[model samples]
Target chain A: MTAAVRRRAGLRELGLGLALPFVLVVIWEAAGRAGVVPQGILPAPSLVAAAWRDWAFADPGLGLNPYLGTWGETVLFSARRVFTGFVCAILIGVPMGIMIGWNRMVAGAVDPLIQSLRPIPITAWLPFAIAVFGIRDAGAVFLIALGAFFPIVVNATAGARDVPRNLIRAARMMGANERQLLLRVVLPAALPNIFTGMRLGLGIAWTAVIVAEIVAVKSGLGYVLWDAYYVGRMDVVIADMVSIGIAGFLSDRVLVAVQLRVLHWKQAVRA
Target chain B: MTDAVAIRGLRKVFEGRAGAVEALAAIDMTLAEGEFACILGPSGCGKSTLLNVIAGFEAPTEGSASVFGAPVSAPGPDRAVVFQEASLFPWLSVRDNVTFGPRMLGRPKDETDALARRFLDLVGLSGFEHHLPDQLSGGMKQRVGIARCLILNPRVYLMDEPFGALDAQTRMQMQELLTHVWDQARGTVLFITHDIDEAIFLADTVYVMTARPGRMRSRIAIELPRPRSIDLLTDPRFNALRADILRQIREEAIKAMAEEERARR
Candidate 1:
């Protein structure tokens, strides 16, 4: 197909994505204005937008609402938790994956246990998390880290294992020692797979953050979501829900941007 | 003359799901120093298996092979292999791939860079040093593969159908480039191919192999003079050698198949 035609097709998809949300907002606002439903149970999109604005910009003389103008802090709290957990997952997961993939002994000893433990949901560990860390940030952080770690480790291991045997032999023929082979050859070969794992793990981290905030500690978008749901502030609850979505979308977009940069070489090959 | 590569009664057997499959049978051969030897055969003739044994990537289940009088055991930098697939590390830059051996062996950066640059230029990839393997075409990746091994300055070049995957034009071009490179370097080359024409064009001595349970059926010495050109392809002498090798390979392949059928019965 012509480049122009392809680009126009892509633009159409983007436009649809942008327009659908606005249409949903308008419909919800109209529903509330006409009073077609009970207002206490569900807030209009307009009301959510106003609460979002208040939380974001903190309008003049906002009274007794600690949430006003504090969107950045709440965002930062969740972002930090995700970031710390994600980094920890990568650091531990990558090396562990390499060892497990490269050595049969390591795989036999460690892979089976990790695979078995992986089936247990991160939410299932909430009680144990709170019991050990005692309702602190560490408990939330632990949950986030645990949640993100599984996918990263598993993907990294498979990636490393999938590296071509010829490439390894070539490396050895080039006088690469075991350490250099692992670092220079195996690590880079496994990067694309590892990045795939990281993206998956980061998504899990966000989910774990919401779960942790709902129970383990009282902070972040998840905490705000739960807190606003109580006392019947449906507008704030809707706004908090939107905030979580935006955070997740933005986080994923950041990852895709990095993936584009790291995998640009791969693109031309396909082209 | 000292034999650069010596294979005396070298045998290899692979244990399969059914039983022991003999990949090579008492394969005894030797290449004189700086000779260009082509191992020619049909598919499943174990030509690659033989190359791998000499390359030290596989151990012979029965006999032994040696390189430069040293017992072949494991892969080492002294011998370089060019695989059918480029088999390059995709993440490394072309220059980095070429310099990989030297850098891994702790050669000085200046020396390695200079050597890499020379080989890249030699392979006509001078302008594409910083490019990743994925960025290059299949032919270019193969060139980088050759350059990487060339930069290592290995004594023996064990190539297992390195250009077999390329299109006709690219394959011809690679063949010419290889001859040019070999002329300059003058290293021992053990080139393997299923193509009779390729064998006739490139090898000084063509060692024809029998199909599975591969043995060296015969060796044909090509007296075709050096500084060979593509024009030689149409020459009557070239066609004669090609026909002889093809006929020999076809007969061997038929015999191999009959043997297989007999065993089944």
Candidate 2:
């Protein structure tokens, strides 16, 4: 296809995606304005948008609004927590997974412990986290990393385990030493699976961050969400919810984009 | 000169839930340097098991397999394999796959690059250097598999039905391509295939294997002239060889089936 035609098609797809959300917003606004829906219970989309605008752009010196000019800081705080936690999870999880999958002794020693710990929900660990780290960022980071670790490790293990037998044999026959076999053959073979784990772990990281902010720490979008709701600032609560959704969605998209690029050979084959 | 490959009393048994199943039984074979030998058998005849033992992918339950005077203990660059599935690394480009052996051995880039180019040309995949294995057709993938193994300059080629998965037309074309390549760079080859015509067309000698607890049932030396082509397929001698192999395989297959029936009963 020509570049122009491809561009037009892409624009059409964007329009199609926006159409439903646009309609939902319009209907919501109409309902709120007509009082068909109570204002206190469910604020209009426009109210939420206006509240988000004030939160993002208003001057903090106004002293009347705590949320004013703090949107960026809160977003950054939550993002940083998620990023650090996710990185920690990856650092521990990928190698642990490879070892577990590749070596029976490692699997025997580590797999049972992981399986036992995985059943405990991140929320259940909130008290333990707060008690251990005393409501600091470390507690939140610990919770987030712990929550994300399971999927990353599990997926990485599965990926490593599933490297084709022939590929290993072929690599060996081609004169790859033990290190080369693992690094060049098994690791690359397991990459697609590792990416899958990362995506799942990232989703869990977002969840862990919100939970940590709500109970263990007193900052970020999750803290603001609970704080806004308690004060009956429903508009800010809705805005915060939207902000979290956007953040999570965008982070997931970034991961998927990276995955696509890294696994281009896989996609090329399918095409 | 030392034999390119030597096997003596090689046997393979797999311990399964049911029982110990003998895959190969007292198999003995040898390949001289630069000779193309094919092992023809029915399905489940353990032809691949023999090849795997020779390739050092599997060890025999008894006896020994050695390549070029060295006892085969592990797979190495000295004995390259072309698998039935054309198991080229999916993540690598065709060029990368073909050059993988030399690159792993830390050969100079200029030398390996030249080798890769030459073999790629020989395999009729010159423009497909950048393409991944997945993007190529079955025939093309097998060609890449051949080139990859050939690039190693191994003492022996262990092919386990490398063209078995291709369609008949593609298989014929691959057979022709293989023979053409073999004529230029002849090595010791232990090719395993079920197709009688394929065995007769490609090998200097054809070893017919028995079904289940596979053993060397018969060995027939092909007297066909070298520099063979597809036109030789119609020759009377080719058909006579085919008939002989067919009769032997049919008897073994029937024996295998009867054994299965007895076990079921």
Specify the highest-DockQ model's number: 2
TM-score of each: 0.94, 0.95
Stretches off by above 4 angstroms in model 2 are A1-20, A35-41, A62-64
Could you say which candidate leads in TM-score? 2
- By summed lDDT, which 10 consecutive residues of candidate 1 chain A come out lowest? A59-68
Error at A103, model 2, angstroms: 2.1
Candidate 1, residues A140-237, lDDT tens digits: the string is 88898888889989988998899999999999988898999899888878888889898899989999999999898888888888887886778888
lDDT (Cα, tens digit) per residue for candidate 2, span B103-154:
9889987898888999999989999999999899999999999999999989
Error of 1 at A242 (Å): 0.8
Clash count in backbone of candidate 2? 0
Complex DockQ, candidate 1: 0.69
lDDT of 2 by residue, A26-83 (tens): 9999999999998787899989888899899998895677779899999999999999
Candidate 1: tens digits of C-alpha lDDT, residues B112-136: 9899889988888888988889888
Cα shift from native, residue A72, model 1 (Å): 1.9
Instruction: Give the C-alpha lDDT of model 1.
Output: 0.88
